[model samples]
Target: MSDNSQSAAALVQRYYDAFNAGDVPGMLACLSEDVAHDVNQGGRRTGKALFGEFCAHMERCYREQLTDIVVMPSADGRRAAAEFTVNGTYLSDDDGLPPATGQTYCLPAGTFFDIADGKITRVTTHYNLQDWIAQVTGTGA
Candidate 1:
């Protein structure tokens, strides 16, 4: 891989490391000031402040640690993607979702990223919401 690609991978790795550590500030430090976040199965939210809010909301509702992370960066270093397994417990009720009762789940997820000046400018996360719902509701096959 090129040096740029290596750096991009490192940046993504750092972001996940912070996430696994439950270090919100550390994760935010890897983002651009005007970063855009495309919520999984939801609309896009722009700016680091909004991202911080999202993180806070997640913190309140769930406890997650991402494992088996694989980061792939484009040769140009302007984009990247990561795949991981989210091992989590639903801690509190989130809006429009099933009531939380400390249900545990393991879900495979991925995130696409756009990087500039060594900071993430955009983040788009993806996962099967229905599958997650089924798992949490004890309806999964």
Candidate 2:
């Protein structure tokens, strides 16, 4: 891979590492000052403050463990797709839902990241909501 591609991959890796470690500051350091992050399970967040809020929310709701992180470099070498599973235990309220039963939940998710100048400028994440609801609520249809 080219240098740019390698750099992008590294950034993606750093993001995941920070997430798994629950190091919000480290995660933000890997992002641009004006980042645009879209969490399908949560909501859209722009800039550092909003991103920090999102991170805090996640840290509170789940203890995230990243698994199977596959980073596919984009043709332009400025972006990549990261697919992984987050195995976590619900520890706090989620989306107005009550706290989970303290059972472990595994969620497969993907994030498309845009990197520029060695920092992540954008990130769009995809995940299943119904499964999360069922896991948190301990009931299903």
Candidate 3:
């Protein structure tokens, strides 16, 4: 484990910490200016500004926290991966999803990151949409 790997791991840890604390500024501080985000079960969105917009939208529609987070960095410090459980409540209606009734769900999720110059350049998140929908809608889907 090189020093750089440790730094990368720390950066990722801080990012999650910021997320848990609902500090959007702190989370953005960990990302590069042109950071790219591959949203869970969705398309790619780039740049910190766009990321902030995405965050705002998420904030409007859902209240979420990540639990049991584990971050693993590559030996070279250019890549990392994280696994966690998303504890969330659907707060408002979102397009292409079941209506929100303040439903609570716990979903397992993962994310991969690309780091450079002590900042995250890319983030790709993964999770099961159907499972989440089923849980939220109570349809056992």
Candidate 4:
């Protein structure tokens, strides 16, 4: 990997590290001031302020820790992606979602990124919402 790729990987690693630590400020520091986020199965959210709100909402509704994180940065270092397993519990109800009963779940998730000037400018995330719902509701095979 080129030095740039290595640095990008390190940045992403730091972000996840902060996330695991529940260091919201530290995670926000890794994003651009005008960062764009594609919330999984939800609408797009932009700007760090909004991102912080989203993070807060997540912290209120779910307890998650990511494992098996693998980040792959493009050769040019302008883009990257990560895949991991989200081990979590439904701590509270999120709007339009099943009521939380502290349900435990493990889901594979992925996120794509646009990096510039050593900051994440855009993040697009994906996961199986139906699977999560099924696990939370005891309605799936």
Per-model C-alpha lDDT, please? 0.96, 0.85, 0.96, 0.95
Q: Which stretches of candidate 2 lie over 4 Å from their true place?
A: none
Task: For candidate 2, report its TM-score.
Answer: 0.90
Each model's backbone clash number: 0, 0, 0, 0
* Candidate 2: clashing pairs of residues: none
User: Whole-model lDDT, candidate 3?
Assistant: 0.96
Question: RMSD in Å for candidate 2, one decimal?
Answer: 1.7
Residue 79 of model 4 has an lDDT of 92
What lDDT is reached at residue 88 by model 2? 84
Q: What lDDT tens digits, residue by residue, belong to model 3 across residues 78-108?
A: 9999999999999999999989999999999
Show model 4 residue runs off by greater than 4 Å.
none
TM-score of each: 0.98, 0.90, 0.98, 0.98
lDDT of 1: 0.96
Which of 1 and 4 is ahead in lDDT?
A: 1
Off by over 4 Å in 3: none
How well does candidate 1 match the true structure in TM-score terms? 0.98
lDDT of 2: 0.85
- Cα RMSD, each candidate: 0.6, 1.7, 0.7, 0.7
